[model samples]
Target: MGAVATPLLAEERVVTLNRIVAVVNDQVLTQNELKNELFAVRQQLRQQGIRPPSEEVLRKQVLERLITTQIQLQQAALLGIVVDEETLNNTIKNIAAQNNLTLAEFRDVLQRDGFKFPLFREDIRKEIIIRRLRQRQVESRISVTAQEIDDFIATQKAQGNINSDYHLGHILVSLPDEATPAQIKAAKNRALAILQELKSGADFKQTAIARSDGRQALQGGDLGWRKSGELPTLFADVVMNMKVGDVSEPIRSASGFHIVTLFDFRDSERHIIRQVQARHILIKEEADDEVKPEAQLKEIRDHLLSGGDFATLAKRFSDDIGSAQNGGDLGWVSHGVMVKPFEEVIFNLRDGEISAPFETQFGWHIAQVLAHRDFDNTEEHNNTRARDLIFQRKSEEEYLSWLRKIRDEAYVEYRLDD
Candidate 1:
């Protein structure tokens, strides 16, 4: 009792190389904790004209991101969002699979880069918490009206842009910031030549596969489908209004330049008429070798066809809680509010009728057409939808602002002195 071992002495007595840098409430952020994030930030800066900050600046940024994360994570906890251990492990495995590596191999690579496995696990855990919290706070509250989407399209038309931008793939011949004037000129010339070849009937994707410098160049310049606001202003402006098979004139930007071709567009064809409102009950197919959502839905369909109560059974069997609690009511979703496959079947059904089992991204759904009013230029309905649209957009803006404020107010300390 008289001789007490100090923590400094105890640490020295053990084989400890990493040091704890910050204590966020009950959580500990260690030196090796932020190594991967710091490395990523450094790499991103180098890709731009920005040089890597000193060890001091990188440390500060890493700690700030972590602290911001911690505060949000705590908020998520307050909202009852907790990432289960199994979820964390599954997320890691999924990430590893996405990178075309086994989980063990991914873990090995992370360890080689000075990142501790537990620290990475905690980072992933925090991300899961943040997402789960947002799903409740934001996604559950998210609602889009048919008028909102239509007005958005109308605005696009007013701007002389494509009302819907297709999945336009591009190959960038960017001049790296450190490139010499000669190198820059050569890159620009290479871009101009690519444009010439494209105009002269060369396969744009083939040339992109051969010569583009952007990340998606290897995937034949495929950027996948994007909505109007999802792309850069200049390129998005040109591509949105162009028909399929249209190519842009050599487009120049700060990141060298690019040539774009709109090879495909998948505008959601299943928009609900503005006068319609709907809800649904879903019985998902279990994931077994022989069973599927369709099979389960078929049984439910028999019950409904026999005049079984829709609302009563919805409470008992529907998997979607957002709607199920209200007797499988989806409230009012405009046409594009649903996935195309589901909406397509629902749109064809008459009011008070039940849809056949339909497959969508979220298992199988058997929808009820509760109400639908014809929209043959109804002024009142249009105005209501317009208001709903504006409200939805305003909510999205408010949520983003809230997230940013949380980020800015966090108390962050760093290990720059080390």
Candidate 2:
């Protein structure tokens, strides 16, 4: 028995291997996934009739995109952010509506385009989750203080750019990285020539397409509507000095030379703000209710006229549950927040005047205006716009930095190179 055991041999194991392009943290990205994504993206570009980059460029870009998406999705899962079925369905419906198609037709189109509807739905769900995760982590973290907004507004006012909206046209003569003096001069001369043509009543868009090297050259450099502090630094000050339909001289930046045309300008925030402190007792109609809602509202109104407490009556009878618990108090509401009919009545009402029972989309309503104030909200609007612009600017910067930080910190292994 011992001699027979000495002759025993070990069994050999065989393995099958598939190519992995990347290893991100604990997850691996397979070559098949990369190839499939690249194919889909190329198909999309072809459908749009846009020229795609070379195979090498496209592969690198697509792989980078996939890796970034994978990192964000992992973060989303760790943070418990999920796109539920109902929300995903609603988003799909909205997408269909935006493309002027019904749900059935949208599915049909997807099938015709060589996409599986289920996979598309999953992709949309993942995209939404990633978006929500980014907003939670990056965009929501940006804060613009009241003092910052005030300072921005004051600076714009000093620059004579307060509350201004400009319809802008731009032509950029771009320079490559690390350009020599001669190249810079040539770019500047090109910009100057374009400026001369623009000032001579030549079509700004046509000139932009034919000669401008701007990113929006394809769209004829139309930079639709922009508010003060929203323009690029090179043109911001120059544009403030220009009237509608005026073109500027060549302006130089690190990336390029610019020539801007002010197609239109307007004082967008010059409006009187009439705000009201009001309360309402809403009675939304119920389908099963036998009594007429209008008659019930009238009874409630009569009770109020007889010195019944508004808060108590609202708590007991008001159907607008949101304000009812707070004694039907709608606090100070500014213009454009309420329905048109509601606003019309509220603005016309004198302080302490209860409106007659009136029908709005939300059934019949009786309201009382506690106070009214009229003031110019132009500065306020400007401050809000400045805050928004600053927030947007900061968010973009922070988002890029955060993305880079995550990417750099991730434990990525390049298996494809091997």
Candidate 3:
């Protein structure tokens, strides 16, 4: 009887370790995995000084997050996306550096804080893979035309608060793509109800944790500081008029209804920088090439110094396809735009001087500085900012929509006991 009881206890332990909490597509999420994630999330909330929601609410939230993450991982695998060891190591090193610790020290700290190093590394790897997958699937497909940038900048100027930044808390009641009228109404009602709760002095972060469907819901829907140009168009229009600590009424969009609270605001500083008009001819090294790229670029530089036509030479020999057709003209570049070696060489050259051949990650180049100026780059900055903001907004919406589509198509089954 004692021997039989020992085996029964071992079997029970095995069952507990392998308990299926949920099934996401082809993957089974174990009880241990869910418990670990829950622990991590609770720790994160505590560190951020936000109160954790009730256990039931938090458990559901964490489970949903795990499901979405598993879906994304499955999609990433299907798309052949992977993070290599070197990149993962480098990313971890950078993270450690940001925290003012060496990699060894960071590992020790994580271990001391009850994190398993192997699991932490794998988590970082998965994050990188997901990021790359998003870049490929969603971000690469988003485009902002020149006209859109012009319109955005013009609108900002008209609004008279181009430099203002808003720190916002948001709650989203999401609707499906092609949602029925009934669904729309239901989502709107839910958003309005949430808004009423907020107005009645319910804690915003706590409510967001329990109810919002936005990506930042876990972080209490805190959409940290955003520039005026960075806000989604719907958010920008609504947020502009709200005072600090003021919550907007539910606003509707294609994705769904949104509720936003303005937590803080501040103005941004003006941008002024040195700009250079430059052009270059690149030569890439190939095994079949008769001449090395460095030697070829040296010859091209000599030709430019000896009264040769730079544009004609660039069109004929430059390997950079984007600039080659335009006479190799890289118009009005600022610092940090070009690769380090390329920028170093270009910025050091005087006006109308052709640089000697130099190698960057992109192979060998001979660059000529056509002109330089101390420019007030506010409009240009706004153009870039607008394009980036539009891209970010589109990416967020498209990603959420895509996630919903995939989730709906997935085979998910919950095994958690009621």
TM-score leader: 3
**Candidate 1, residue 125: how far the Cα is off, in Å:** 2.2
lDDT of each: 0.69, 0.79, 0.89
* Residue 9 lDDT in candidate 1: 78
- Where model 2 places Cα greater than 4 Å from the true spot, the runs are 1-19, 43-49, 160-293, 298-336, 339-378, 415-418
Global fold similarity of model 1 (TM-score)? 0.42
In model 2, how large is the Cα lDDT of residue 372? 87
TM-scores vs. true structure, each candidate:
0.42, 0.56, 0.77
RMSD of each: 14.1, 11.1, 5.5
Steric overlap count per candidate: 6, 0, 0
Show the lowest summed lDDT stretch of 10 residues, model 1. 267-276
Model 2: weakest 10-residue lDDT segment is 7-16
Candidate 2: residue 177 Cα off by (Å)? 20
lDDT digits (tens) for residues 243-347 of candidate 2: 888888888776678888898888764867878999989998888988878888888888888998889999988999999998899998898899999988888
List residue ranges in candidate 3 displaced over 4 A. Answer: 1-5, 177-186, 274-334, 337-375
* Deviation in Å, model 2, residue 339 alpha carbon: 6.5
Better of 1 and 2 by lDDT: 2
- The per-residue C-alpha lDDT of model 1 at residue 83 equals 78
* Root-mean-square deviation of Cα positions for candidate 3 versus the true structure, in angstroms: 5.5
lDDT-wise, the better of 2 and 3 is 3
